[model samples]
Target: MKRSSDRTIKWLILLTPTVTIGLWEYTRHAFLLPYLSMELGNFLAPFIVLAVTLTLVLGLFRRLEQSQRALRRQQAATASLEERESLARELHDGIAQSLFLLAVKLDQLDRTAQDEAVKELSGQLRETVREVHDDVRQAIANLQQPPSPASDAWVVPLRELLGDTAGVLEAKAEFRWTIPESRLTGKEKVELHACLREALINVRKHARASRVYVVGESEEGGGFRCSVEDDGVGFDGDPMKAKERFGLKMIRDRAAKIGWTFSAERRGELTVVELRKAGADA
Candidate 1:
C-alpha cells in the first residue's frame, strides 16, 4: 500500500506541472494572448515546475532514508536472534552434555559401590548431577525463547522456582517475600535466584527437613536479605565444611561474584541459609 501510494504521489507530482503548462498555453492562445505574453508565461512556468519538483524530490529522499533505517533495524534483530540460538546450541552441546556424562558416572558408582554409605553417597551425587543437568537445559531453553521487552517482577519467577523445588524435593515450603520492587537489579536477581535454588536443593538432599520456610525482607536502609530455614538435621560439625560441598560452594561463589553476603549455619534445630546485598541507593 505504501509503495503504491508513493508511486501515485510521484506520478501526480510529475504530471501536475505538465497538465498546468498545457492548460496555460491553451488558455493564453485561446483567450488571454492580449494580456499574457508567451515569453513571460514560458519563463515563469519553468520556475514553478522546478520548485515543485525540488520539493517532491526532498520529500522522497526523506522517505527513502526512513525506509533504509527500518531495513537496518530488521537486520540487526535477525542477527541478534541467530546469535542467541548459537549460544543455546553451544550450551546444550558442551555444558549440558558434560553434565549428563557426569550423571552417568555417578550412576555407575552407585551400582558398583561396595558399602551402603558409598552407595547412598553415589545415589545422592547422581541426583545432584541430574538437577544440575536440568538447570543447564532450562537455561538453554530460556535463551531459545524470545527476549521480553521488559524485565519481570522478581517475585514472579522466584515463586515458580520455589514451587517446583518443593514438589521435586517432596517438602512443605512457605515463601514470604516483602522486599521492594527496586531492591534487585537484573543481574542481582539471577545471583539471588541461583543462591536460593542451591539452598533449596541442599534442603532436599542433605537437610532431611520436612518443612522449609523462605523469607525475603528489607534490611536497615535499602539493603535486603532472603533466608531459607528448615527444621532439618542441621549442619554436622563445622559450617566451614560446606566449602567441600558443590552446591554450597556454587552459591557462595555466585554471591561473592555479585559482592553479596552468603552464609549457611545452624540456628537451634533449624538450618538457615541467607543471601543478602546492601543497596547503593541506601
Candidate 2:
C-alpha cells in the first residue's frame, strides 16, 4: 500500500505542471484572449504554471512522506512482536519443561523411602540433568537455521534442500514440516537454512548412517522446532568423541548471532540436529 501511494504521488507531481499549463493556454485562446492582451497572457504563463506546479508538488510530497512514516511504524511493531514470541518459546519449550520434569522426579522420590528407590531417584535426577544439557546444546544449533515466514507451505524448498544435501549420502531420506510459514521472518528462514544445510553436510561426511529424517513442528499455540535425526553412531554412548566438532561450533556461533537455539546430538541409537524457534523474538 505504501509503495503504491508513493508512486502515484510522484506521477501526479510530474504531471501537475503539464496539466496546469495546458488548462491555462486553452482558457487564454478559447475564452480569455478577448479580455487579456496576447502580450500579457504570454508573459503570465510561466509564473502561473510555476505557482500551480509548486502547490501540487508540495502537497503530493507531503502525503508521500506521511505514508513512509506509517509504514516504518508498522514494521517496527511487527519486529517487536516477533521478538517477544521468540522469548516465550524459549521459556516454554526449554526451562519450563525441564522444571516440570524435575518436579515429577522429586514427587517420585518423596513417595519411596527404600535405599534402592533412593538410588533409582538419583539416576533419574542425573538423566534429567543430561536432558537439560542436551537441550541447551541442541537449542544453540537450531537457531542458526534460516526461516521463511511462519508457513507450512515452505516444505518444498526444504525438501529440495534435503535432496540436494542429504540425498547424495546414499541414505533413505524422509522430511516432514508442520510449522506454518507465518511463524518465521524472512531473515530467520535464511539463517535456519544455513544451519540445516551444514548439519546435513556433516551427516553425509561423518555420520555413516543409513537413514536420515527431518521434521518440523509448531506447538499448539506455542513455539516451533525442527530436527534432523539419523541412525548414525549416537554421540551420548561415546563420550571421548562427543566433543564439539568445528562444524557444530560454527553452527552454534551462527545461532547465537540470531538469538535462536540450534543443537546436534547423538543419543543411544540416533543422532539428532535440531533448530528451535520461539513464537517470537525479543
Candidate 3:
C-alpha cells in the first residue's frame, strides 16, 4: 500500500508538469495565438502549473498517504490479534499441559513416597511448582498488556516488541532511537527489526537480566548502529558456540547477508549484541 502510494505520487510529480506544459503549448499555438501573446502566456503558464500542483497533485498525495496509513494500522491490528491467539494457544497446549502433568506426579509422590525419597520428591515438586508459577505469571502479564497503536514511524512496532519482550522477561526495557527517518533504507529497517527481535528473544531465554537496553542511532558519516545490552549474567561460554543458541547464529548470518557487522560480547557488566551498518560510501 505504501509503495503504491509513493509510486503514484512520484508519477504525478514527474508527469503532471510535462503533460500540463504540452497541453498549454498546444492550445496556445494551435488555438490561442491570435488572442494571447507568447510572452504573457509563458509568464502565466508556470504560475498556473504551480497552482495546479499545489492544489490537485499535492492534495492527492496527502490523501494517498492518509489512506495508506489507515490500511497499515488495520493490518497491524489484525496481525496483533492473530499473534495473541497463537500465544494463548501455546500457553494452553504447551506450558499448561506440562504444569498439569507436574501437578499430577507431585500429588502421587506426596501420597505414596517413602520417607527416604520424600526429601528428593518434595524438592522436585517444589521446583516444578515454582517453574509453573513463574510461567503462569509471565503468561498472564503478556496477555494483560494493551496493544500499542500502529503508525508510519517504525518506532511503534519497535516499542511494542520491546514492551512485549519486557513483559515476558519481567525486565526493565529501555531504548533510545535517534536514527532519522531518511537515514535508513527499507531493507535496513527490515534487517534491523529481525535482528533486534532475535536479540531480545535471546535476552528473554538466556540473559535473565533485570534490565535490558536497546539503543539505535544514525552515526556520523551516514552509518547506522543498534545495540541490545542486558545486565544479565553473561553467556556461559562463547555465545556463538553455545549448543542451543541458534538465534545468535541466525542473527550473525542475517547481519552478514545484509552487509552489516554483528557482534555479541560481554561489555563491562552487560551482555551486548551490536549490529552496525557502514556509511554508504564505505
Each model's lDDT comes to 0.77, 0.73, 0.80
TM-score of 1: 0.43
Which parts of model 3 have CA positions greater than 4 angstroms off? Answer: 1-152, 280-282
The model with the greatest lDDT is 3
User: Model 3, range 25-53, lDDT digits (tens) per residue?
Assistant: 99999999999998999998998889888
Q: How well is each residue in 88-191 modelled by candidate 2, as lDDT tens digits?
A: 57866877677667767766775665687786777787677667757765554444343343323446766776776566777788887776555567987788
Error of 2 at 245 (Å): 3.9
- Candidate 2: stretches off by over 4 Å: 1-155, 220-222, 236-244, 280-282
- The TM-score, computed over Cα atoms with residue i paired to residue i, of candidate 2 is 0.41
lDDT by residue for model 1 (1-282), tens: 655755765776668678766876787789988888879878777776677667765676666665565566567767877898999999999999999889888888877889999998888888888888889989899889865422235566666666776777677878788775555678877777778877887777777677788788888756888888988888777655756578877887888888889888887878889888876555
lDDT of 1 at 61: 60
Of the two candidates 2 and 3, the one with more favorable TM-score, higher being better, is 3
lDDT of 1: 0.77
User: How well does candidate 2 score on lDDT at residue 47?
Assistant: 99
Candidate 1, after superposition: displacement of residue 58 in Å?
49
State how far residue 167 of model 2 sits from its true place (Å): 3.4
Q: Pick the TM-score winner.
A: 3
